[model samples]
Target: MSWMLILIYACVFALTCGFSYWALTGLMPSGMTQRLDSLKDTPHFVLTEPSARWQRWRDKLQRALSWLGPLSSATEPEDASHTFSSRLRFYNAGIHSHLAPLVYLASKTVLTFALPSIAIGVLWYSQVSLSQAPGMALVLVFAMLGYYLPNAILAHRVARYQQALFNAFPDALDLMRVCVQAGLGLDAAIDRVGHEMHLSCPELSNEFELTGLELRAGASRADALRHLSARIGLEDVEALVVMLIQADMLGTSVHESLQVHSESLRTKRRLLAEETAAKLPIKLLIPLVFCVFPALLTVLLGPAVISVHEILAPTAQGA
Candidate 1:
């Protein structure tokens, strides 16, 4: 039975890998393929002007690769950009961060098998009299759970990351405005804000750094910023980028425009805080009933209960 289970698991693993790779690779749009390919052509820097040994080695490696030319430049046919749902479909199917997806799926599969095996082992040790037929049914349930749990976890993580991005974006915009108004250019402002926020909140800072890199790589500032907003799927950042682009296009003073936007953003943040504060009573009520009230009642009633019990004890004894 153990050997049969192992064989079944092996077959299931193979099928999962084969089917996932086939479906995901087939669904990956050509544009993403081209974008990933272009990333290979990006020039790498290594502080060649004189630095540590690691830096020198990196420069040499980059130089060697540059001299060798691109491995293939045959110009693969490109597909049109996909809509958001289509993009998410590919991502969920395993286009982005391959290792994370594989690890998640593998762990889910292992846990599925592990849980039932553990339950069966416990039952055996407990001298339970469950028959083999019931045990097989439990094993099948475990296998199905293991197959689906990772996908559910991935969906949850994606949603959480999206929420964090939304919460962080407005602050990032306000910081950018402050830097711009304080006499820094866009690139300098982004670098400063990214550096400042690196320790406190990394997601928004990392996005800013990526935008700076794109600007350095010959992509226009607007394009890079728009891409940053799009990648995080945050509405505030998208609107901010649109405002910046319009300000630049219409020859408006960036500092003044950003100042106004920053004020508005701060107002929105304040309003959100107020709203959260207003909801505190509702949020606190559950804990008050479950935790606080019980303790309070015990404290207040303890002496009274003891006194009444003493009085009743004497009366009952006399009767």
Candidate 2:
């Protein structure tokens, strides 16, 4: 029995080590790293510090893990549709990786198996005598939780990204209005705004930069604007895109349109802020009732209750 336990431990350790090695090697940026290596003898080549080296390793690990992506056994048509939806989710989350869907799926698969395996190992090591049926059921529950965890995290990221973009859009639009009023064309204004907003609103800046790149790459203005709206997945941004497209088609005054749009965005932002503030008390009510009130009541009543109990005990003794 001892030998069997030892063998199990050894097998688990070996499997873990093997997987780690495979992941590391698979994730390494061979093309980029090799190019760097070839350039190492050049005068301009600066050696990376230990921290930079570590960062590179960490980035590679992330990329590798992401590459494991979703598994699709559907027909080509179905797979394509699935991929499209997955891609949209990745885009919404600000994950630009071509393999994001696959990586997400892979992560889900790995966690679903890995978490339950770890749970079982720990249970066994602790010698918990769970019946086979119950034990398997617990493992399945763990697996299901693990499977959904990635999706939850991705959704959270997307929400955060959208909120950031939404908050930044009004400011960006105002800046664009200024640039347009100053005689910069739409393209130049976008590029200028992207550069200026980099420190303040990196997400918006990146989207603008990508739009600029698309335009430069020969995409039509309408198509590029549509793509930007699609990538952002925000109603406000979609409205802005539609407005810009209309302004272009109708040969309207870009500067005037931009100014109107900026004001509209500012009004929308203020409304959202007021709405959130209005809900704040309601949101806090649950904690105040369930947590704070209980603690306060305990502190306020505890001594009185103890005093009453003492008084009653002495009276009963005297009687």
Candidate 3:
């Protein structure tokens, strides 16, 4: 029975890995792929063929998993605002797939059950009786953790993604400013700056590249920038978009306005850095008190305390 349970859990885990890999890869069509497809008379859209016998089994498992998709999404409200918020979260986290929300919700559903199942199997394999185990409570805890794990992961990704964009923005703005001053149109400057930013910050570069593509594809400047802001879900970028749109409308010196904004961004970045530096000691204080101080006190006084105890114990007993 233990072996059977272990086998079942192992299969569940293996299938999960395969499903995640399939879902994540090639979900977002690349620019190069799109360009190549445009050249083709008819480009087919289908799942990649399995390269091995095992993958065929995996494909079947994934198909079966798809049955749970409706179950997960059924709980989601059919409001546009909620859908937009969900889209914004995934896009800001750098996942551009149309299917990301579905994948995310479905994964949450699977994990809710899978984690508790795995835990139960492990306990069984360890020869712990269900009654001896925390049982249903432990199962519920694991289930809850699994349900929220993807959310935590998504938030982490969004934080890192935003940080990357924030850190890269000042330099990118400076480059764009230079390009504008050198007489390049805003669209050309954006595309060029995006190309140059690839090595330094691929994430921002990709976003800019998409914006540039939209511009070249005949999207209105205001609409393109708004879309960019929507995808980024960043206040600073949105402000920049508004500034540029206003500058365009007012016939103001775009180059000068951009330069000013770039300088402000640099200053803002520096101030943020200084503020973080100032907070470091406060951040370190907790660990210093909880971890370092106790260890230091123990080491420094341990011998003397032991000596005092040794001397006092025997004397008191003798007296």
Candidate 4:
């Protein structure tokens, strides 16, 4: 039974990998179509073949997962604020899929049941017997862990993305300041900065690119800037947005505002670095006490203790 279970798991894992590979390679539209489209002088309708079997399967799975969304919402209807916050989190983590929230909820639900089922299967296969209470408790514990796992992963992604944005903001501001001082309009400067920062600071570049896109799509500059700040979810970005809006409204010098904000951001970044450095010793204390100190003490006292033991052993035996 154990061998059979292991074989089943292996087959399932292999099948999943195969599906993933097929979806990535086979389902994606070929570059040939893009090249052909680029070469055409006049725009013409292009007829393409239907999606592959893998794509159909993926679409079906997505549809099935989406069903869980309504069920989840029916059970626990999120408030407008919560929905907005979830959207912000998803955006921050770079998930722009329309079905992201549905997929996330579905995953949580599936794991909540799947983990306990796996645990039970493992226990049954191992022939381990336990009291009913303890068995239920174990299942519940696994379910809880699995249920919260996605949240933990999302939180980590948000933290990492935010940190990247924070680190890149000062540089982006300096670039913007230079661009503004060089006679570029605010929108043009933003677009230029986005392009220039693509290699060095991709997260900020992406935000700026989206803002430029919104501006081009007919959004007001202030609205686009506010949306950018909201998507970034950073205090520095929010401050920059407010300053730019105020400067634009008051017809003040944007270049000067950018320069001043850039300097202040740099100072804040320096202070943050110093604060982290100051906390380094306290952070290191735990490892020093629990790990390094023990090893050092063992090394220093080990030889003397062995010598004493050897000398005492002979004397005690003789006596």
TM-score quality measure for candidate 1:
0.56
Clashes of each: 0, 4, 0, 0
Stretches of candidate 1 off by over 4 Å are: 1-98, 127-171, 178-188, 313-319
Candidate number achieving the greatest TM-score relative to the actual structure: 4
> In terms of lDDT, which candidate is strongest?
3
Q: TM-scores of all models?
A: 0.56, 0.75, 0.77, 0.78
Candidate 2 ranges beyond 4 A from true positions: 1-77, 126-134, 317-319
**Candidate 1 structure quality by residue, lDDT tens digits, 199-283:** 4455666667777878888998788878776666656667778888888788788777677776776787789889999999999
Q: What is the lDDT of residue 103 in candidate 2?
A: 66
* Model 3 C-alpha lDDT per residue in residues 119-199, reported as the tens digit of each score: 787776667666743555666778998899999999999999999898898899989989988999998999998888866
Ranking by TM-score: 4, 3, 2, 1
Task: Evaluate residue 136 in candidate 3 and report its C-alpha lDDT on the 0 to 100 scale.
Answer: 56
Per-residue accuracy of model 4 over 42-158 as CA lDDT, tens digit each: 443243565799679778979899777665466555799888988888998877777788888888888888988987887676664445565566678779977898899899998
Residue 283 C-alpha lDDT in model 2: 100
lDDT of each: 0.66, 0.81, 0.84, 0.83
Tell me which residue pairs clash in candidate 3: none
